[model samples]
Target: MKNFIHDDFLLETDHAKELYHDYAKNQPIIDYHSHLSPKELAGNRVFENMTQLWIDGDHYKWRAMRALGIPEKYITGEAPDSEKFNKWAETVPYALRNPLYHWTHLELNRYFGIGDLLTPKTAGKIYEECNAKLGLEDYSARGLIHRMNVEVVCTTDNPLDSLDHHRDLAESGWPVKVLPTFRPDGLITIEGAAFIDYLSSLSKITNIKIIDFETLGQAIKKRVEYFHKNGCRLSDHGLPHAYAMDFTEAEINNILSERLQGGTISKKEVAQYKSAVLGLLGGLYTEKNWTMQLHLGPIRNTNEVILSKVGFNAGVDSIGDFQQAEQLAGLLNGLNNKGHLPKTVLYNSNPNDNELFATMAGNFNGDGIKGKVQFGAAWWFLDQMDGITNQLNALSNMGLLSCSVGMLTDSRSFLSFPRHEYYRRILCNLLGKDIKAGLLPNDMEWIGKIVRDITYNNAKDFFQFPSYVEKAPLENG
Candidate 1:
């Protein structure tokens, strides 16, 4: 039979084919947000087999396997790597309408050149072929990134991290710009069980005494300066909702003291502490011209049993139905009023808030920045095709789609770069359909420029990462 993932797999019409092949296909990826390990990139680690390369650290596949009634031993337990691959192969055919089905075949075709369907019958042969490729130098971590034509990758990092790996990668002179993004979720989450421990770690990292909120802010500022000097120009936070409650510095100090002293604080105090810390960080981000990304509305660790076994990020998170609009507006407005609202990207996991987020972004889109406040790409559980289309449509209808920054991997696996290709095809197909239906004018040249901008230029301009300036220019399509 024919190849399953041909050049025109997702490109349905001639217009779609032209857009994908001519405009979107060859654009260099600027993966500004991902969970990839900086150590792996720095070390250039090679994998032993398909399971180690593909299935490990991929919670998407784990969730699917669990849904298929597969046991934990086969999924994440001490089963042999080959057996895990067999279980994943068996689960693939059942994921027909899921994004995993498309992602699986696309990754297979792109990486391993395997065109046959992944089922029980073809599992053994495909496994061997991929394992053999994994043993090659070109399939190493750094090599895989280079082969995908990635110009830049910004890995998420905690404030307490030493960033030795990032320094190593930068000094080694890898062609791909591997940088760090400041993620201060641990510092801001005062109510979490690990709050005190995180504070102690931060104290150790910064060598600052954590007696009050002032000292805490100083510690965070010190780390931000360190990160900035080390080529970081972005910060990210994952919160259930924006915290904008008003509180004085003294009140915040009191709250921090209570929490540090093992005193139980109320929810109101938690909000006050969070608001104080986030607001302070927002000012720092603005001062340094950093792009701040807010990922809101994820209800994490819902299943205690599964969470106990697997800890966090093992696919037990779901969308939250929290009250977002008022607090989000308050937070942004407070920063804007102070002229400290840096370029921000807002992402919501709840699909019902698509229009809410799009319009909210529009409310703060001035100051000569094209898309200063952006509706971030469909995130978390909403990264599927339907969810992506909904987010795109909402942004197009409510905001300026041309100025919107494009897709990112947001994944922990190196093989997830194909997700960017998947997103680009879907994008081109949408615009092509619009042109054919006369919803948008038939102007390929103008449309193509827009396509290229969203695919690469927007992010490159939006995030003025220090490494981008230090490195050579990216190749043109």
Candidate 2:
């Protein structure tokens, strides 16, 4: 029987095969945004089994297993590791047409050199083989990253974090650049239950008492400077919608004081506070010449029951339909008016906003930088093939796809780097189809340069990290 994951699995045309194999396949990955634990990379930990490496903290697979009627015990509970692997194997056959189907086979093939289909029949043998391989040095966390040709990884971090692990990794002379991204969502989430606790921690970390909005801004600025000195060149925010409410500093101060006094505030007040803080943060990012990424349109923790049981990022978030265009325009315009709009990337989870985001990015894109404002790669919930193609088409139609910096894992697993390969094959196939249909000129050399740039070079030029090629040679298959 033919294996499902062959060398040209997603590359359907000869043009795609040539482009992917020649230009995109071996390009080093610059995962500028991810949620991988820096501690694990610093420690160079090795997993004990396939379950630990493949299944742990992977909510994508968990969501699929739950849909297949697998119990939570086997998915996230106290089931034996082998039992969990068996259950995942059982679920794989049912995941046909899902991205998981391709991702599973891709990971198996790329990481373990296993091309056989994962089934109840092959699960035990495959599990044993992968587990045996995990014992080797090349399968450790750093080793796996090295094997994937990863050049730079920017991890999401909070305002109060120490970044000690990042320091440790750098001082240890690790070749890959592991940097931190400033994520101050907690500060903007003024209505969250833990808002007060978060403020307390920030105060402790910065040694600045948070009395009002001014003090809060000053403390956050201090942390931003600290992060910048430590090699942070990016900031990330996740919001259901952009906030651009009109308010004064006095009003913001009163609102913060009221909220800090354990008072209940209205939604309008929440918007005012968030807008003030986010606008100020934008100026800070501009001052330091850092990129700011806005990930919008996710309504997280929709199920209260699940929220009470498992908490956030546990696979319960969904696309939000909030009116994004007006307020998003307001936010960017407000920053641009001050001449403080930093290089920005806008990512939307809802497919409805694909064209809107692409066009919105065009509104603010000049200032000498090629892609100063970008419609980021199809984001969470939109990272699948159809979603990716839709985003690509929208950007090509509405903006300059040539200058766009492309894909990131946005993942928590070390094994997820194959997603870059998956994205490249899909990208090449799209261009290949265009050439074949006479929609685009038959120019493989130019197209191949675009492919290589999107795969690696665009990110290198867009970001502030030292060049990877200057430091070390990229690994090739």
**lDDT of residue 182 for candidate 1:** 96
**Residue-wise lDDT of candidate 2 within 120-203, one digit each (tens)?**
999999999999999899999998888899989999998788777777787788888999899999999999889998998888
Candidate 1 has an lDDT of: 0.90
Candidate 2: how many backbone clashes?
0
TM-score of each: 0.97, 0.97
Model 1 lDDT, residue 95, Cα: 96
lDDT for position 466 in model 2: 42
User: How many clashes would you count in candidate 1?
Assistant: 0
lDDT of each: 0.90, 0.90
Residue 439 lDDT in candidate 2: 88
Q: List the residue pairs that clash in candidate 2.
A: none
- Residue-level error in angstroms, candidate 1, position 228: 0.7
List the lowest-lDDT window of 10 residues for candidate 2: 468-477
